[model samples]
Target: MDLGTSLINVALLAMLFVVAVAIIRMRSLFAIVMLAGAYSLLSATWFVVLDAVDVAFTEAAVGAGISTALMLGAMLLTSRTAKSERAILGVVPFLVCVLTGAVLIYATIDLPALGDAASAANSHVGAQYLERVQADTGVPNVVTAVLASYRGFDTLGETCVIFAAGVAVVLLLGFGERSLSARSDKGRSRKESK
Candidate 1:
């Protein structure tokens, strides 16, 4: 990658880290959901820097857009603020997360460098796909050809999954006579009255 693109990627990663920290610390459901969306957008930007525009588009649309909307809808059924928890109770989960992160980082050590021409992927299937895509699919753009022709069923499956998720979220949040939030509020009021 060029220096400028690398710098942009680093900046986006930093932003994503900051957003993640904010999401972890915040008690407000709305704020946390917004930060999660922002984190997804930063991730999409980094993917773009890596020349994975298709993945970036998917991240932006699904992660930032649809997922955020669904989460906000789900959040409406719960209290706006999270219940406070004892700090000691968080220690085990925090340590588990740290260990998982360390393991994941260590696992990347043996992976080939990005864009390495000698890498197994770049030297084999990727090259073969590039060579045959145009003739097989009659598509000039390899990415389009791969998605629309080579992996058509996979793409359709993904689209169906996203659509199903949206429908499920809508049904969960909006199908009842009263919103889940309203029912919860009414129950709280009845308890208070008693």
Candidate 2:
């Protein structure tokens, strides 16, 4: 990658780190939700910089869009401010996190450098997709072709999973006016019978 792109990536990552710290330090649930959305958008920007436009689009739509909306909807059923509770700093959890991060970093040491043309990813199916996507799928956009045609089943399954999660959240939150009315009716009947 060019120096400019590298700088951009570093800046974005730094901003994400700052946002994460702010999120963890904040007590307001509303602010935390907003920061989480911002985090998703920043991640989407990073994906774009890496030339993963399809992944960026999915992140923006699902992460920044649907996720934020669903969280806000759920927030409507709860207090805006987070409840103050005793903070517990568990040594085991902290140690586990550190060890996991260390292991992940060590694992990347053997991976090929980013954008290496002869890397396994580029040499394997990626090149074939880039070369044959137009003729095979007749889709000009390689990303779209690969996502919609080559990996259609996987994409469809992901979409279904996301849709199911959204539906489940809505149901769990009891968001509709009908459910609220039904709850009120039940409460009234119980009061009258009592």
Candidate 3:
């Protein structure tokens, strides 16, 4: 990658790391949720810089937008601040996280350098798709052609999964007007009895 692109990537990654640390350290539910959304936004920006606009849009919409809204609604049903807890329980998780990160970094050592033309990802199948996508699919944009034509079923499955998950989240978050009205009626009955 060019120096400018590398610098932008580094800056976005640094911002993401800072937001993650803030989320982990904060005790207020509102602050943590906001920070998590910000982290997702930064991740989306990073994806854009890496030339993955579609993934970036998905991350921004689902990760930052829908998720933040859901969490904010859920947050309203509970206390604003989390209860203070001892850090003793966190040590094991922290150690596990560090070890996992180390292993992941080691695994990447074998991967090809970024944007290497000869890398397996850029050769053979990818080249073929680029060359033949227009002829086969009659789509001007290769990315759109790949997603809509070649991987149509996979895309549809993903859409269905996302829709189901959104429905499940709404149900779990107690957005049912019937339940709210029932709880209020019970409270009114108790008040009237007194």
* Candidate 2 structure quality by residue, lDDT tens digits, 1-194: 78999999999999999999999889899999999999999999999999888889989998999899989988988899987778899999999999999999999999999889999999989999998987898888888888789999999999999899879967885557887899999999999999
lDDT of 3 by residue, 30-132 (tens): 9999999999999999999978888999999999999999899889889999988776767889999999999999999999997787899989788888989
Model 1 has an lDDT value of: 0.88
Q: What is the lDDT of residue 40 in candidate 1?
A: 91
Instruction: Report every candidate's CA lDDT.
Output: 0.88, 0.92, 0.90
Backbone clashes (count) for model 3? 0
**Stretches > 4 Å off in candidate 3:** 89-95, 166-175, 179-194
Per-prediction RMSD in angstroms? 6.2, 4.8, 4.0
Q: What ranking emerges by TM-score with the best candidate at the front?
A: 2, 3, 1
Candidate that scores best on lDDT: 2
Segments in model 2 whose C-alpha atoms lie over 4 Å from true places: 166-175, 179-194
lDDT of 3: 0.90
lDDT score at residue 32, model 1, on the 0-100 scale: 91
Better of 1 and 3 by lDDT: 3
TM-score of each: 0.78, 0.82, 0.81
